[model samples]
Target chain A: MSILDLGKACTFSQMQLEITYKGEPAPAAKVWRRVKWQKEKVDEFKTDEEGRVELPEIMERSVMQLLPSEFVVSQAIVVTYMDEEYKIWVNSKRSPEKNSELDGSDIHLKCELTDERRLVSDYESDFLTSCEII
Target chain B: MTALDPLNAAELADDIYQVEDEFTREIFYEKYKDRFELGKDSGLSDTGIKGKTGGILLKYPHMMAVMIEGKKKTSFDGQAVFAVKGTAGLMDALTDLNAGIKNARTGGKVHQGFLDVFDSYAGKLPTLSSNIHTIHCVGHSLGGALATLTADWLKSTSGKEVKLYTFGSPRVGLEHYASKAQRSIGAGNIYRVYHKTDPVPMVPTWPFFHIPDGGEGDFLLPSGLHLKPWEFHSMKRYIKSSKGDGSQSLEWSTLRSRRPQDFLDSSVEAWLKSNSIVSFTLNSARLLSAAILWVVKKLTNLLGISVVIAGSTTFTLLDRLAMLMSKGLELAKDVSIWVTRLIKRMAQMLGIVVREGAEMTMRFIRQVFIQAHHAVSELVRQAGRTLH
Candidate 1:
């Protein structure tokens, strides 16, 4: 599973990550959860020196959550086809944000590591606003 | 097609005159000179490529990217072909084999590399037409892979027959894509060239050639055929060479090469007949250090039990732990010494590797941007995704 079950779903807990022999952290590791996360309803910040999105809010966010720059669209992530590995993409959708004249459907991503060490655009879905009141 | 274009084996045999006199390797360096430097956004790098005078881009990667300048000269009939300049690395070196030259990723990057191989300027392909004419694609090493990708792209997009010419290319397809690619660019259409001793076109697994254990149809598994962005990314630098039109001065011809087999015929032959020691080794000190770390971690989690002594002589049941504690400390110190030394060495290596890798990566990313930009610019001229 992309996110490991640390048995802390919806509750407060600290989690450790499973590392592969290759020395990279699993895509989704279980870390501290349910801590008093302070997420601002509005987020506008740049990545810190570490290239991690140090959100003012308690919750950490992925790069996809940021503004759309050519940078995000130009990265790579590996996925296996049949058994052989071929790289598809994690780049900008080929279609430009122009009038409906072009192919209008260039949906591919670079799927790679960017200079920031963040996985670029490969956003599963664009933003959909949500809210909860206490 | 020109009088020189339609080269039958016999006709091709005659034209095998010395091309070395006209085209030297210098054009390869001259055309993509800017690639020797890096982009402002990418920061700087030291690629350590050859013939480099003092310049901004240093390190291996900056050497990877030379600026790509493209110019097209038509056939006598005015068909447009493009030439660019860039450098090649592992990916290009690997995919320049007969088994390696297929798939969009392998092809895409290799094509870019081919363009970058020499200061390119060559015959053009006719503008988009339904007519079945062939696009002649060619390169060496990574450039060869790029040649194959260019042909594949042209075949898929241009609705033209693709005549590919490659030298020492790597395995382009996993077991999956090879068959179909082989068929599309028939033996007649595709001429994969290789000289005797070039180990480069054969190493590295990026141009994945073998099928998993008992996986599938050829060494290429079906999954490998999916030309995804990652695949192209795997060999992007090689693709940089596709921006080729070798010089009015072409590169040193492979035909001029004295095949490696001829140079070391007997020893190589004997080894092929009998030596089979494909092995890798581990460092003993490193292994021992790892064991020490594992043991220390376990001990750190255990609770320490202490007992107060009522008299001059203190007798405790769990006091045996004293010996264990001392031993663990000694091991920990040893491990620390080794670890610190190892870390320093690793840091030195990483610094050099990452610095160069970053430079190559930066140049590579720029080319991807440029290529994607080209595709975007051409979006205006693109018709719907309908096949001709």
Candidate 2:
């Protein structure tokens, strides 16, 4: 797993993910991760031969977060394959706790390029995605 | 011929965001060249943040608005369109937090933050030719508040006909302002569109009210499971809802929204007693808030107490509101039961549990109000942080 020190802000919990296209491994697919709250800072990754990508913890140092404001980290993930971009994950993380995205469960997910994106509403977070927790 | 055209206005409101950046500004100008006549001076100026005083020093122009004249074939022919951008930075959100009421130049009291920004940029707009018949003010979110202010201002000053279009806007003024704006702008000339779940339109509570009084000539779209305020407040959602299919505009006839009238005392009590989970949806929040407002109004009316806030007292709107409810609890058993239910419902929504037979003191009600306000402020802050 890679750790991207985006800025001087907080770091997000790491997630393990697998990407598949048409029921086959999507090797070398470009993956982009961006925190919507942070302007102009997007980290890019690539899938391995086994269609697996280890999403490292994203650390952003934002003074804005230090204020007594909301801890809403708008997280987005998109994958590019064959000149087309597909959104795999879009979520607003409402907490600063580790693994809060997965409700304190392990951060392992399987995403299918062909799967339809769906909205999952929980107590602390709300996300729309084509990925599922494994 | 200047009938309300919400879809086209919504498109302008969504597209105005692109002009915020220098690179995208050119693209935005190019894309709309066929329909509008654009120039350098078309950019409206605002006191963008520099440092310290929160834009008091940096009185330069930002790409917040685009003043364009429509071509002959367009629906906005012989008219001007001023599209404003929504909240774009921390400073802008700071402006949203300045919810104090101020006397509006347009007639009644209005939101201080909205009026400050509108006044900052209104003078920068180019002089309209005599040929232009109407001015269409369009925006989303904060821009919606600006549009309302601008519409009211133009209607009062410009001699030209003024039309207002907004999406997911917060309440801009009090009752007097709402009624004044409704009369001046002609209720039919304003199109205030909002999603049922968008929390932005529900805030600054009480005293502050939406224009076109009682939601007349308003468009309320149905939201999907995206109950989160930010998702529902997105300009993309408004644009999509306005355009039904790829080709046809959404027919207003089939898109009539169910206006939520004030809940009766019985309805409020029934919902509280039904043991239904008070979820985080906007409707639930609104219903609970309305019920609380109803109780406060009823109590104040019964006691012949003036609901006005005395500037001398340190009590805030919520503080006074909760105090009234607590006072009501002491005078009548029915008030006690209703206040208890209301507190319980609020606790359930916030994932808190009120123990059975616990004393419902003024402090308890005040604490609940603080918790609820914190939750709402968090939602607003999150939505405000969608900067880029």
Candidate 3:
């Protein structure tokens, strides 16, 4: 197989997610990873008392046939807690190849208190989505 | 973050370094008596009771302060801060030169000289037993080092929040001491201000380190300006640099973020090498010419030539040699200026890299390293040729 074919083979990696509010662990927050364009939910998880969640292994797949030849499938993890939502994007091409498990030390979701407590507004969601990918 | 006021801290630090004669002390008290109640001065001796090594105490309604004095003479302070010998009589000087940490009564290891100085005055300090909201420790140079130890001691013993402000402090202790002190005093309470070119803050050269807890306020000279290292270390310069604004300069709460310990560690060696090269290049030619003239005069007198002939011959030979030496000195000066310009260019290039947001890229870093190596090597080669 060519190097591109080898790279396209199914590979699994576990992502450990942590949620913190002002440097303290935030527990029981709702989290889910979804495809950006399709709005299709891939998985859902919740943080434990220590504000940690270990997602099941994720598979890397090439979506060349579903979209354009250069298009790649990516995932965005959305976390909602206490009137705030944090979005973390994961690029499949940049995922670690050597390690089967990735500790989400850098994947910490910082939750800030909103000035007004209410449902997540569409404007806020769009703003967060359009902001920096991480 | 710190309960201790920055203006109060700066005033205390500036006051401690002044000449501590009775008249000066009275003047200092007069200036701040409305805000602070001056306490007894602690002197340092082998017994911790009879010398000029300890600091004075200033008590406010909510806070108690320990202000340690720097060396009495500016020249003495300069010498003591840079001396590499570990056996120096000055407690802070010895601490800077000493390599390792020693056990403290409070359960962690600390710099031995610092602990010794603190021990000498720990009993006499009234704040040790008080219910003060904060204990402020302020000093400059050697006194700055002592202030750090005092803050650590008070934090561990009294459990009171300790605020430390040091001006151009030398390295105080090892990594363990720094970590422990950070924990005890809370990182936000330590404010260390050093001018960009100050040499005092660069030693007891590596392995020894200072991680300022609050954050380091580095006062850089405005672009294209240079101050002699001594001038950078001066309390007057530090005061002027602050422009009487007592608050910490920037709001970066994290300690050692911009200039990490490793960056400082490496800079110490670079600073020393540059200083030695500059001093030797500037002085060696003049010294050599003076020596040659002295030898010629001695030889003429020893040969018992007639006074007139001796004087005339010596003048003729010395004049020719002096002319040659002047050319050499001029060449050395030119080389020195070129090296300085090269360094300035390197700094400007690095500044550009930082401004361009390429500082973290491996390619940019490698390019910088390569350029720096070439410049340093060229400087070394020039110095070598001059010496030859």
Q: Could you say which candidate leads in DockQ? A: 2
Off by over 4 Å in 3: A1-134, B1-7, B39-101, B128-131, B213-224, B244-388
Candidate 1: tens digits of C-alpha lDDT, residues B1-388: 3211312211111111111111111222222223322113221122111221111221222122111112223231222222111122233222222221212432322222233322122122224333324445544444344445456556666665555554435445433344456556554555543322223233322223311111111111011233221122111111222212331222223222312222133432233234233211112222222332233334444423111112323321112222333333445664333323322322232232224223223233233323322332232112111100
lDDT of 2: 0.67
Q: Considering TM-score, which of the candidate structures 1 and 2 is the better prediction for this target?
A: 2
Per-residue lDDT, model 2, residue B76, is 58
Tens-digit lDDT string for candidate 2 (B80-147) = 88787764332333334334566789767776767777777777667777888888989887778878
Write candidate 3's Cα lDDT for B1-388 as tens digits. Answer: 2333333444455554222221122333434333433344312111111113321211111111233222333221211110001111342233222233456655545555556655655566543223234556667665677677767776777665666767767667654566677777776666787654444554443224574522343322321154233345545455545443443433323223434222232343244234233322212322222233232233333443221222233332213322333333334553333323333333443343244322223334334434433333333233222210
Q: Evaluate model 2 with DockQ and give the value.
A: 0.04
Which ranges of candidate 1 are over 4 A from the true structure? A1-134, B1-86, B89-132, B210-388
Q: After superposition, how far is residue B305 of candidate 3 from its true place, in Å?
A: 71
On a 0 to 1 DockQ scale, where is model 3?
A: 0.01
For lDDT, the strongest prediction is 2
Which stretch of 10 consecutive residues in model 2 chain B shows the poorest summed lDDT? Answer: B44-53
True-vs-predicted CA distance for residue B302, candidate 1, Å: 53
- For residues A88-122, write the lDDT of model 2, one tens digit per residue: 87665545556777777768889998898766644
Q: What is the DockQ of candidate 1?
A: 0.01
Each prediction's RMSD to truth: 28.9, 11.0, 25.1
Using TM-score as the measure, what is the rank order of every candidate, best first? 2, 3, 1
